[model samples]
Target: MRLRLKGARVVDPGSIDDYKDIIIFDGMIEAVIDPSSPYPPVMLDSSDPSSVTKGLKSEENDTNYSEAGKIGVDNFPVEEGDTNYSEKGKVEASPTVSGEGYTNCSKEADITEIDLAGMVVVPGLIDMHVHLREPGQEYKETIETGLKAAARGGFTAVCPMPNTNPVNDNAQITAFMVNRAKSLGGTRLYPVGAITRGLKGENLAEYGDMKQAGIVAITDDGRPVENARVMRRAMEYARGLGIPVISHAEDLSLAGDGSMNEGIVATRLGIKGIPNAAESTVVMRDIALAELTGARLHIAHVSCEESVDAIRQGKKRGVNVTAETAPHYFTITDEAVAEYDTNAKMNPPLRTEQDRLAVIEGLSDGTLDIIATDHAPHSLLEKDVEFDRAAFGIVGLETALGLSLQLVNNGSLTFDELIEKMSKKPAALLNINNDIVPGNPADLTIIDPDAFWSVNPETFFSKGRNTPFAGYHLRGEVYMTMVQGTIAYHRTDGGQ
Candidate 1:
């Protein structure tokens, strides 16, 4: 099958950024042509729902992706970077991002065309720290629903934590998740294997075997490896396997019985608070360990200012360290919990406004490498409880991109930089190649940076309704998400 996307401003962050016509065939980027080129003629059979050019779009609305039919072999000039690529000499990326964006149907089929005029087409977003509860806790979220949420959010690939019901600590659970994602068939789901067997923090999980079984990075997320010796062993083992060790970076003992950040609000509410030290201490320890073991250490859900400082110092010291922060860390603070909203609750709890700004600064200065959602999902039973009794997370997949774009709109990051953090940086971290160029996977995202949309959890694709930004008006919207060259999610409205 062949497809052409016309009239869109192509943005691939660290790669290519310009107006281009994209041609895709057999799930790979066949070509990236000039936007001024005349589009191959296409016809719409209005009577047939599946006809080419059929789309839920507004007339000339400026970004609807309609189907195109016809494969005209033309001499299109390709971008130099599109043709040039460094070989994959790096270690395997964490199970991350999408196809060069294609899925073949029939070679003889007519070309499908999608017009993306006035919209921004970028490399598909990749969230390296998403929680997909399956093989045990399906009520909160399932593999199917989680990936749907990701696709709806413009993310084509996500790395789900291994702290599931069965704990993806072994090959069996790892294989189960890989096959389950294959069965669900939407955005790509990569499993992060647990670092400790059952995440007990005592024994190390089989990193070598788990790597072979489709696990990407090894992590003991949802819980910290309190035992330094055990964690060191896990790192050494993963280093040998050549995969990253993603640390949850929290001192449970220090964070004991705490519900929100240790701040004025917590003092006023008379609720126990978690101090910044809890996260920073672990980050400090992990960085030292990474230097000691010579392994790549990636800190997950970094929320406080001190942790970012520690991570920055780690990088300065030449430790092989990378860190990620969620949208909530930079967008919302513990003040959100003043209303006792469980949706604002999360592990490594939301910190003070000072910390929030620090997170944005971290992104701006490159102290932070990625913007992951840490997209933990919880059910009503878990979130509807009292703030102190509620679960330690809220669903995030649906809001990460819109909220992050807020950073762009405010000039905190350039459009290219935001796409870099959301798509390219995460892909490189996971070792997935999703360059939006010829001979690459056509995995891509079409975004309307100015599209105003209100958040509504009731309409969310994820089973989890736990969110604090439910009624927040967001600046951008995901027009369409394509993975492995297949249309995965399109805005119901024609991206006119």
Candidate 2:
């Protein structure tokens, strides 16, 4: 089938000149033509005899024509002795109309022409960290529903964390997630392996076996490996196996009995707080372990200024350490928790304005490598309880792009830079495909960066509606998402 997406401003971040008009045929890009090209034949109007002249007049100023004045009534090929014309010039008959050709070509080719006049066509997004809540807790989010949310959010692929009820520690469970996601979900789900058996943080999970089973990375997630020796050993083992150890940077001892960030807000609300040191201390220790063991360490949802500084130093010192931050960490602060909103409650809990500014700075300066949704879903019954009893997560897969674009459009980040952080950088981090060229998998996202939208939880594809940004006006929206050249999601109705 031939599909032509014409007049789109293709933003391929890997290139120097980011915008171009691309032609795709048979699930691959045929060519990237300049929008100024005049090769694509314009359809002639059969109803009006004067239509051909109008078409020629439109292209009269084209650079392909040297003398625009040469085209006139004498040059136009009109029907000989036609009553519409005063005189007959060199009569040139209209091209033959082939009914059979039109039928056979239209049927066989299945040409789909899309005029994306003011849209930006970018490589489909990849999220390296997300929680689909499948295998158990399907009431909160299933593999199918989570992928649907991902597609709506312009994500072509997502890596689901290994924190299910029966954690994805063994080869069988990892295989189960892969199969279910492939057969039943819209977005590609790369299964991550648990760092420890059942995420107990005591005994290491089957690292080599899980890697053989196709798990992308290993993480305890929410449950950090607190013991330095245990973490060091896990890192060394994972490094030997050529996989990364993702840490949920937090010292639980310092975070004990804490419900929010240690700040003026927490104090005013009379809630125990988890100090920024809880996160930074773990980041510092992990960087040291990574340097010592030469292991790839990834800090998950880093939410503190000092932690960013630690990661910056780790990179400067040539430590194999990378980090990702969630949208909430950069966009929201402890002030949002003033009303005891459980939606704002998340692990590595929302910190002060200083920390928020620090996260934005990290993202802008490349200290933070990727922007993930961390789309953890919990049932309303779980999140609607007391703030202390509420689950530590918020549904974000459906709103990740919009929130990221809010930063870009606000001049905090460039569009190409945002695409790099969201799509190519995440794929590179996970060692996945990061191509926008021909013959590559057609995982692409179509975005209207200027489209304004507001968050409405009722419209969310995920089962969870625990977003703190509900009803907040945001710019930019995903119009369509494709995975492997198949349309995964399309917003037929106009977005906000």
Candidate 3:
């Protein structure tokens, strides 16, 4: 099958960022044609209204296609009276032509020209850190539900952590997660194997075997590798196998039984607080280990200013280190827990506004290379409890983009930079190339920059309703998400 997506502002970093017509065939990008390029334009048969506007009805039909776009196996949106070739114009590309058509090349096959005007198309977003509680804890989240949520969140791919019930430490568990996600088929899941066997932090898991079984990286994500010697050895082993070691930068000893950030808010609320040193000290230790072992070390979910400083200093020292900060780190702070809101209670708990500015500055200056969503999903059973007894995460897959867009709205980061952080850079760290170009997989996200929507957990596709952003108004939304040339998720209502 052939498809033509027309009239969209394609914001592909390191490539063309113009109004182009993208020709996709058999799940791969065939060509990206500039609309201004000179080529013969094929005319449509106006006498046949069906040929003029396929699947779209006129005013008399009483079936308005423009009100809310429809997705079918054989039909795409083509509004009546629209002229953006993507809408009303059609170029019948001859299969025999080479470098002589509206596009540089044409396949003499049927093309579904979709009008994507007023939309911004970018490479599919990837979240390098998430928790899909499957293979054991299906009560919290399953692979199917998590993938559906990811697709709806405009993520074409995600890397789940190794903190599941069975702890993805062996090749069997890694293979199980991969196969389960593949069978579900929507968003791509790259499982991360545990660094230590059973996450005991004593013996290193078989990195070579797990890598062979489709594991992309290794980490003891939910818990930090407490033993420095074991962490160093794991980094050394991972470096040899050409895989990254993702560090959950936290010192449990320092963080013992603390519920929130140690600051005025915690003091006011009379709750035990986790000091900033709990995370920063471990971050410094991991960075030193990465430097000594020459491993590609990645710090996960950096929340405090001290940790950001440590990562920045490591980068300045020419260490093989990279870091990611989640939207929560920059969007909200421990003050969100002022009323003891359990949803705001997360591990490496939210920090002060000063730390939030540091994370924003890190992203702005290239010190923080990626924006990942530590999308930990938990049911109400775990979240509907006292502040200190609640689980340590909030569901992020559905809210990451809307929250990250705040950076662009405030000029902290340009739209292109935000897209790169959410899409390109994460893939680079995993040693995967996700550039939007000809011959590459047709994984794309269509976004409506001005669409306004409120955060409603009842409408969320995730099993978890644990989020602090509920009832908050957001100014952007994901209009559609496509994976491998097929629409994985599409907004079918006029919620905007």
- Please, what is the TM-score per model? 0.86, 0.86, 0.87
Sorting all predicted structures by lDDT, with the top scorer first, yields 3, 1, 2
Clashing pairs counted in every model:
28, 1, 1
lDDT of 1 by residue, 350-426 (tens): 99999999999999999999999988888888988888999998788889989999999999999988888898888
Q: In lDDT terms, which candidate is top? A: 3
Model 2: per-residue Cα lDDT at residue 397: 89
Model 2 off-target regions past 4 Å?
A: 16-19, 36-110
Q: Residue 276 lDDT in model 3?
A: 95
Candidate 2 vs candidate 3: which has greater lDDT?
A: 3
Tell me the tens digit of each residue's lDDT in model 3 across 403-453: 888789889999999998999898888877777777888999989888888
In model 1, the runs with Cα more than 4 Å from the true position are 38-110, 494-496
For model 3, which pairs clash? 95-108
